[model samples]
Target: MVGRELYRLLQCPTCNSRDLAVYAEYVLCAGCRNQYPIHKGYIDLMPRQTEFDYISKYVSEEESMGEELDYREMAPPLLAAGVRHRQIRRMLELKPTDIVFDNACGNGRFGLWNADAVGLLVGSDPAVLFADQALAEMELAQADSRRLPFVDGAFDKSLSVDVLEHFPRDVIHDYLVETARVLKVGGRVAIFSNTREMSPIQPIINISKRLGKFFVKQGVYDFEREARRKSDHIKDLKTWDDVEAALVEAGLKPVKVVFWNSVFTSFVEHVLMKLGESLIAKRRTAKAASATVLTDEAVNASAGAQREIVARRAMRRHLTKSSPIYWALYTITLLMELDLWLFGWMRTGPYFVLAEKVEGRYVPAPLPAEE
Candidate 1:
């Protein structure tokens, strides 16, 4: 589909030069000679790799583990009502000529899920292996989500799922600014992630760590490591307000904001998750009903009691190490999460956001006077 007139008529997204030319299967910027590979039928215009936050190694390991523990793949039942997925589906309704950007397109999860709908699907990620995987599966470029190589207003719509929460609050603004720069006027971006309050395990994990060593609690904090690995876990997470403010400051109008996956659904998920884990454990335990015993409430309750005792002793060791601010914030977050889960109002699977790029006069810089 990318041919001579198509190549000639299209300017370098980076340089705005009609001097673009097509090579073996790529479009090159005539001014800079930057080669943008054409995978399948789409051109990748990202410049350098540093634009992504570098998660190749982690994602690789995850992919391997994901295969072994196919349990994670069963989440769509819980996420069928995801607001973010709905938003992406809505974006797919745009005209074929409209450009679309899939940021942090890890393994092209969302891109491939909606590929046939959008016209120009540009997928980018930091990890070479991840990009490699995407290219192998569908088509994606090696580019950073943070610093996309596209020219201003390159895409008519963009979508990022399960990405924003992992970044530090400071980096989020840059992400939003970059998204705004790449999207054309009236372009929309839908982001999906967990709100801080929605996850109760975080505070519990932090508290357990502070007291784990001296208190010697054996298994109470078992889920901590697993919880951190979820895409929503952040070193310094943002509240919903902070996220909204960042989007607004980046010159994108907030159209819709919805939260999903609160503790209610979380409880159900946890139970199913434990069932999955038991399936793993029983395969190794023995040839007897011991696995059944392990699954029973009596055994689980006794274990829970022992854990509480250890936790009580351990917590005593860290009596002075309390953060009132963190506790208050997290508690509120928890309450909100609980409300979402129980009331079923705010507990949408994904926070579906619709944002439009702010349009204004594009004043070109004055040309240099002749010497």
Candidate 2:
């Protein structure tokens, strides 16, 4: 991907000053005199050189242990994709010429999805692996999300998907403030996260996580397996309240926080996770016994089988018995879908909460009721 025009998108990460001068790869902050250097076409915007614990733990250059793990084959949550992309496109409706930032952009997939609408797309992540993944998909600069290498209020739109949970609760406020700082006045941001009250699957997933960790402790699993299965730097499990509070504290106007619900999202997520667990187990044993180099085709085949297993589990969950809480959650989710259908939002999405930033404050609007 070609880098967007430097003059239009460059900003001082610390002071948010437009008085930035760029030469080759270095951007100088006129206000603070802080120097942000560019390396390999990506800028380093961190405040100080400190180790990113999460990146160190989760992203590493090692072969994945396929044993006792299976979530790899699952497609991203369909509902999430629809809602997130729709919100991104909608930001265009709010402001067509906004510079957009995808914070902690894992692989540049979201940036690619929204590439056409935004005036310019900037994706930043601390992990080199994520940057590599993003670069593989499209040209993106390597930078830190916390200390962005752009001017204050330079961007008209920003987004972070499933990223806040990775930080400790105390520091999440700082992240939001930084997000607000980078956004232009009256800019909008879309945040997608998993809330504790949002679904019952959190507990189930947590239990599975513990079980997987137990296996690792017993020497049945390895580091790669753990990294692939669980995140290391995630410090908080946010609920709707926490999300709203963070947004408010950050000084961005909260327009809406819509709860999202869709069969595709839930189904794809559930099935893929089940399969990931299975594949991890299978790979562990298969690799140990075989001395031959593993081919991409072989890995894909393993992932495909795991996908099938996830699909099967999804069907079973919908048809078979579950806990009372699950039934309640399912019923509520179904109701949310029905509401979406009545309002003609299902094709686009449901459970979306929209927010707008006005006068350095977030103003949230109540979710539209089913028509």
Candidate 3:
């Protein structure tokens, strides 16, 4: 059951009120009279409750993302794609009394990773399909970024990781506004998102790029498949200035901004990390293909996503912390950190921002009804 402390923080995602009633199987907001369901502990508090493609992608039919994996473990940097989970955690400077929100908390993994150290970690996202499997330290909610279910000034800190690229261009400001609204005045938010901009030193990056493609041609990595998947959900890769403007409009002042993926990071993430995950994904996909028969639903549904999930799980299984291979790749990741020290000031993609709620500038907006 969801605890009383969480209930005190609950507000109607639609009306933004604390007049909420906790029931056996659902939470009802008296202000809006909207009942959000809780199935075996997964709470769905999204205002619109519309069908979204994220459900298909993140929640595979064969195996869920966190089904067999330890929820608190971070992916080895070589297979983490570009999340920078360790770096993000360091930047947050979490306090024991802090209550943080894992905004757009994909699978609630980050929250799980940090839950024990903080007062509370509430994860809210469009998809809460994975929350049923979540451990007790964190609370997960199915809520929209543009219209959060929490009341005004509810949290001390927020972390928005790998989420901006997925939001549409038009709603980026709305998302920030909601973020600012939920944070107490002077509360900080750690944001990790990408800009459309590429590095000024593109020629140097292309050196590794060429070698990466050569490896792809030799069947060592699926560069084309990775590119397609990377491009699929990216709706808004706004420039850094646009991001700053959006934050200001939302009443969040940028305290620190760091440009990442400059040189070593570009090579490691785009080339090396892709190679590692693709190789693991390929072998795992092949094994699954040979072992299992597909149902009609599997054929019609997001089969590619399911395969990728299986592959990701295999990568985690093999890259256990005790494995020397994990440490070896981690050393490369440590070297990759040099880019942050050397070239972070330069203009480049996937920036990290620490913004503070400035107070009195943003107005909360209602979520549009499902079309």
Candidate 4:
């Protein structure tokens, strides 16, 4: 289980050289004499920490939060994980012989979960701390999205899910260029990202926030802060036109675009999310008040117990047939399915862009057929 496939596929990030040989504890690049360590069964290919401060900070915070919250899980009752995964599979058209790359692959769930379907799957992220689970399934490396560590035309397909939103506006073009650089001709790149437009349920969400403010005054909840923290977007792509232009600038030819997650579904998902947060907060507050003195062990024990409770609650919410949360999620998923079928062409929530790398200018290759 030496991950020989990855050894053959990856290049030295420092020199863009493929003269790599696997040592017992590291990969040695004969061209540049740079040795990258293999820690916890995954390669550390990041040349330096030049552009990953935000990712480092965010991953540190998320690690401290423990395993109670799953970062990959989408908001319940809207945009279910299963639904999204299905859409991704269709968009990428993954094949048994395809070699795929996941850039900015936070947590690496998309590639890890689909390991059986593809020949060689590789996931890279600036934040390597959250990559343990993904490493178990595919070859993972801590590498920058703006400077991918693979040689040119190494991959048959590439994907970036909910990752571009975190990139600064100025560097997005560079990121896309790096993504295109690593893909083989006819290889497609699929991106799911948020734009500047508010979800269709902004008015309802505003009214709900106003009502939630009264709860805050009564010392019952802080829904507004919770919502704001979750909805924070670092970079804004203004519109679909902007997204397309960026891809084109990076030598990618856009082929398809679709907007999904309807207004009604998003509104309901937020309401449920706020309610869940309030409930968890209340429980934590009660536990804090009941404990007269707190020690590190006591705090850890309390957290462990809370995680168990939350996991059980989530299981019931998603699995139990009679549970209201389960039914609500099912009904919303069905409705959203219908919405996509009927009006997905209209501009709405976040959109997915499918594009292919422009090969002629960069390297000679036959033109890809239209989708």
Candidate 5:
């Protein structure tokens, strides 16, 4: 099991020393005399929280709503998330004997889903809690990605999703350095995050967003609420070239690059699915005894719990295997994947990338120009 050699991979985030003492209650750092508390199933390795300029929703919102939401019932590799996760898995090219790290592993969504397929999974994030299923299947840690508490060349491979947007150029290179530092030589890491540019199919996305706003005009997907959520948090707006340059600087050579958030994903998720969820939330509000509609902020704040309830129900239907709805969803997911095939070559919007750790300098390969 991964536990047998887990300490071999871990180090002190403060002092970067591997002289750690593991105990029933905590892991003690010999160099810094810092004790990391082991609770619920994850080690808290977040550095001085005050130094952080941006706070993740996982740290702020999810922590408060933890009591009402059972992470064990949550599904990560389903619906829209599944689209990104599928591409990530393909980029990772996982192996049964490889030790993998899920960096920025929010709620262990991908880790929990792919745990059985790999030898071991170590999910780390700043503040997100792990599901019971993940605790049973993988090691969970609360660590900052920029300063991971892991020894150099610790993992065979890693995957990070939705992390690049939060890291500005000033900080993102540090994160990439840490990422490359933890991977073994020639080891590959899968990355899924966005650039600042518009997608090749931006017009289609415009149409989809407009359709959703016009038809499902509801509190759940309000524009102002979304702006409030993303305006500050998504500060990393570098171009693909800038990101690739940084990756090379960190000794990680990008081997494969494919983009997402195009025609299929935008229409299916932004328009169709949002439309359905908005309608459902509206009906639920109307059926309330007081018949009071929630404010936009309330709708956004409670979205996690609401979606989980729906996910749990869908999980039951999926477990049936014979249910027609299960196949319906399966088919829709497959259909969504068509966007990857259609738009993968185009360098635009969010992307899934596979990069390997190399010793020498890495030269950038020019992707086919979109023009």
Candidate 6:
């Protein structure tokens, strides 16, 4: 039954045809006669030619970088993918029978975390490594977000976290339109992304980055790769109003908007990150200088040990009844929560927009007349 349902949702990317049949390990489209292979439990639906050269390069880099880090350990508690997933679940009122689509699901963290709660979870990403990671828990496909291969109205909800900003400015609207096309009428979509308004803590972060660079010169830090990672944000959204306008133009009705991660929380998290990275760098430098041979297993065990120590410290801090720092952080968090409840639409840190697809044929917004 599940396999039949999955078959029904798939369509030919070239022809947008539903005349599809499942062969041994390929989905064949009778309309275009295109055969898409199923590899490692994921259907490869990526089109042969992409609209932009940058898209392919970006996806390739993402896949290559996937082998470098353990995202679960590096993610901070304040802005973790789990944190975003919980917010999406609450905002969309996700139910056990809900069919959810996670568009541009890099690493598939959100989908994997909530797969057990939803009836069907499908994750689509251009990066094949992300699909490979998600295949254990949910149906995954290697496809562009702007050209999803699913049938219209196939999903009950769609969620995208920190994905829109990576797209070129010219194609963001197309991505939203595709998001609406795959969702059922009145189905909700949630998007979380960084805005153009720099958070109050951003200046401090910049200062820290400079300090980090200086430390690198002194052999106390190494952040050259991290510095290069910042170039991925090709399209930082300017404002929440712009986001809402894009959704409305794409045939989705805006439902709820909220901002979170206040200045205080961000500052604290930055400090923690800097401290952790410095310690790790120091250890690596010492090991290298001493010519100490460390096996991959040993290195992984050390990282795991460090993560456990940090987790224990975090737990103890939260549990401590009379600690001043704990109370201060708690208060700051409460204020941020209140700010979201009171003034989410106003410019703040990262913001979320929840919208529902409107019924009717979606007419693309007309291009502006020539001056």
Best by TM-score: 5
Count clashing pairs, candidate 2. 40
lDDT of 5 by residue, 269-299 (tens): 6676665555555455334512222322223
TM-score of 3: 0.81
Please say which candidate is ahead in TM-score: 3 or 5: 5
Candidate 4 per-residue lDDT, tens place, 265-311, comes to: 44444454445645654565555533521322223334433433443
Q: Which ten residues in a row have the lowest lDDT in candidate 6?
A: 289-298
Per-residue alpha-carbon lDDT of candidate 3 for residues 1-371, written as tens digits (9 for 90 to 100)? 25666777778877777888889889888887888998554578877544433432333422333332223344544524334666667778899999898888876766777777789888876654343345354687777777788877889999988788766655676778888888999999998888788888878877888877787687665444344334435636457887877677678889898778557865875677766666666665565743431421223224444454445556566676788877877788777777777877888776889999986555644433433
Candidate 3 wrong stretches, greater than 4 Å: 48-83, 129-137, 232-237, 274-289, 292-312, 360-371
For model 5, give the 10-residue run with minimal summed lDDT: 289-298
Candidate 3, after superposition: displacement of residue 91 in Å? 2.4
lDDT of 2 at 364: 38
Report the lDDT tens digits of candidate 1 across residue range 1-371: 23332342244545455577677878777787777787553456555322344343344465432322221111120132333454457644666676677887665656655656666666666543332234544555555555566667778888888777667655666677778887888788877665555433334334434443323243323343244346345624346665666677778778776555444334333333333333444344343334433343323333333232233323223333274533443343344345334443443334656677878843322322322
lDDT of 2 by residue, 189-229 (tens): 88766544534333443554565456556644334432444
lDDT measured at residue 220 in model 2 versus the true structure, 0 to 100 = 45
**Candidate 2 CA-lDDT value:** 0.53
Model 1: ten consecutive residues of lowest lDDT: 69-78
lDDT (0 to 1) per candidate: 0.52, 0.53, 0.69, 0.66, 0.71, 0.66
Candidate 5 segments exceeding 4 Å error: 48-57, 60-72, 218-232, 278-320, 360-371
| Residues 190-272 of candidate 6: C-alpha lDDT, one tens digit per residue | 88887677554456446645655565577653433343344577554476666777788789899887776344334434344
After superposing candidate 1 on the true structure, give the runs of residues whose Cα lies further than 4 Å from its correct spot: 1-19, 25-27, 34-84, 87-98, 128-137, 198-228, 235-237, 280-350, 361-371
TM-score winner, 3 or 4? 3
Question: What does the lDDT read for residue 241 in candidate 6?
Answer: 67
Winner by lDDT between candidate 3 and candidate 1: 3
